[model samples]
Target: MEVIAAVAAGAIASACQNAVLSSWLVSICPQRDYAKELGERLSRNAHIYTPGSDNFAAATTRWSAAHAPEAKLVVIPSIENDVAETVKYANELGMPYLAVNGGHGAIKTVGKMKNGIQIWMHQLNGVELSEDETQAKIGGGAKTKAVTDALWAAGKQTVTGLCECTSILGPGLGGGHGVLQGRYGLVSDQFVSMNIVLADGSLRTIDESSDLWWAMKGAGHNFGIVTSVTSKIYDIIHRDWAYESFIFTGDKVEALYENINSHLPNGGSLPVDIMHYSFFFNNPEVDPNNPLIMFFIIQEGNMIVDPTYTKPFHDLNPIAVDGEGGVFTDLATWMGNANTSPPCKKAGLVNYRFPIDVESYNIPAQRQVYDLFASATKETPALNGSFFLFEGYSTQGVKAIPSESTAYPFRGDNLLISPVINYAAGADAEIDAKAVELGENLRRILHEGSGREEMHTYVNYAYGEETKQNMYGYEQWRQDKLLELKNKYDPERKFSFYAPIV
Candidate 1:
């Protein structure tokens, strides 16, 4: 309430770009009232939407304390012209804005605004499936579940994020990774074309024909607001089944990772119908001494029996087994709480990433990470979080395209290794400090063994205060090009928010 004066005047300034058309939503409404308004809007449209303050607050809170709250005005622009009007107003007022789809961005703070516009992109949620069911035009706001359900109903398939709540375009823009990643390629690779509203408030279509499309691949959000995205869809070769394998504690973590790295590199044509993830949890109901660690594989339809897909891991003798027929979405739900993040009880987050190599097979390094996490679990008993490690599936499909095609720079790297430590929201400062300490310890152990340091960080998984350059890791030429694009297109820095380059 105290900040309403500035926010209101600012909103007025922005809406005036097309005074005849633009609608002005309040910049700062009471949190409770904001939720009611958002729910009402959703009730009416059921399709087009701008998220409420609760949604933004929940997302902001999920971020580390260093970047808790941003984006004052939530704008729902129905058409491309409306987006142009919104952008033009922000440009004239020199106010920053952030785009939101499913609000599933991993770089939670990146698109935040101090007190500017939050252009909620969910308003554009239409999907047009092709007659052959091999492709679709998905509005930028469509979530994975929306696309999956839509495509499934049409008896087609497209590689999508395994987590149902993740937005299709949001993740695809940054090189989407999912269960199908090992087969078809990262989601960005599936991009056929897209309609984008540029910083100048004009519309442009991007695809292989335009250099801008290449730039949009990995560097998308930096240029403009995306209205819709087109991607390849495949025939439904299989349905109503997802193969699952749960590798437990005695499976030998080191060997399991090694096997994964070896198997995921083959292109999809080689039988990569399986999606994989590993989990480490301490269940009071199970074991108090050693946390229960499990690995999961979800094979779509008949792909469950594909030897290359399940054989490598099945040989490991997983302790528990559930091989059944179910909807992929149902399988995701059965997995339980696929979307619960670490309660944001802290001020900072400490994360370290290194490239995965044969050294990851070392038992000492594996135990080192596990021991460090175990101690933290005991020390901060109130902190609720777990450490995770995953490798990038092969770039066969992603790399088949020229490197110059997109802003994603990690195509050259075979795998990505990440370790995380999350804690209660209010406990961020201490939690961050401890996580950093442990991260450094793990870094030293791994790097000393592997001889690599501070190399690259995954954009989707990066956290607070680490610079943007570190996450992108482009070559000198590409970095220069990005900076040039930032200056040329967004010269006023209206898009700069959390973890920004400008």
Candidate 2:
């Protein structure tokens, strides 16, 4: 059966060279316990650790269906040398490489490596806090959960990915968001430096002072592989409170958006420590009539500043359900692992990073935008599980840095829109077409409605080809410099796997 499967897959690969590599590539099994084995191997070579099969499975499965079961050797490289060797071999073979720091991003580039290598980096999990405990030197392959747990153990905290399994470096390379973002800015913002492996099989340590530091923050992946990330850690004192509220359909769609936007307005009197998100989604588990807009509220300090922050939502309609919890790793766990997200069809986003300077979010065109998305969901029952996510990063820590200082352009932008359209099985053409159409349609609606198309996307969420530009709308000069660096450092482009900038 295995041989037959291999032969069949090989035939498919031969037919579609871009999407599948050669059938000769070794298969990594879901049934086998490879994570721990790989983890041990990595630990020995690099004086670091490796991840097990379960971890690898979680990451690999996160790939979109179009790119799943990617061909090529699925090597569980545990050490930096293993990674370098993998790249070197691929380069020598005139092949490409995909670096899976944490299999979270839905980008298809890595999975479409027809005849290349998949370097799983999860084994590089090393975490240590600085002597002063104000900084942490983290392994490049470490997940947000691992880092968070380490920081929490040391009585400290840092900006990191909200999803547990997402790698700090993976998301940091392109400006990551988290609950701490509202307080500490982006995870990238907290980064002090990184030990990156250039595509040329050389290692380079970068910091804010490094000529390439600024570009590395938002456009790091375009340059090389990061083995370690040094980020500023914060003093530990309080684990705050957060609330999750759900509002069902009524006249609440527009009102819900308006109210959420109001609380997070650019000029609002809300505290910088206050953060929240509104997710409009369909719940397959719930009755159809129970369609809901899930609202999440987070306050930095343990003390609740104002219940009124949720008043806008409360006024919209009666809460269908409400759940509140104290901060800690619990919040992180509740959000979910990187490999598994909410039950939604993984349609990516038309990300927007802009100040709430626009007068109203419910303008006719804006309303049309909402209606369009809502209509799309209703019309396509498959997308009923999809949702729109809008997050307001706390300005307390991030705003202090000038936007121009880093590759991220929206330092001062108070609002970020990440719309996700998730659906289930369809013809390849149909799924791809629908996903692309939805992304483009959302972009058009936002631009035409708000007259503001120039915005940065949350790289973690954006999908497909165009997301690169949308997520990194910093400046042409920055992008140009990154490309030049890519040419110089990764001239071979071995590291251009997942959302590779080049």
Q: Give lDDT per model, in order.
A: 0.60, 0.63
List RMSD in Å for every model shown. Answer: 7.3, 7.9
Candidate 1, poorest ten consecutive residues by summed lDDT: 350-359
RMSD of 2: 7.9
Candidate 2: lDDT of 21?
A: 34
lDDT (Cα, 0-100) at 158 in candidate 1? 84
Off by over 4 Å in 1: 1-66, 106-112, 131-133, 258-270, 301-319, 334-363, 389-395, 414-416, 439-450, 467-469
Model 1 Cα shift for residue 269 (angstroms): 11
Task: Tell me the TM-score of each prediction against the true structure.
Answer: 0.77, 0.80
TM-score for model 2? 0.80
Q: Per-residue lDDT of 204-296 in model 1, one digit per residue for the tens?
A: 887888756766777676777888888898876666566565646633676666676576443333245455556566665656655566665
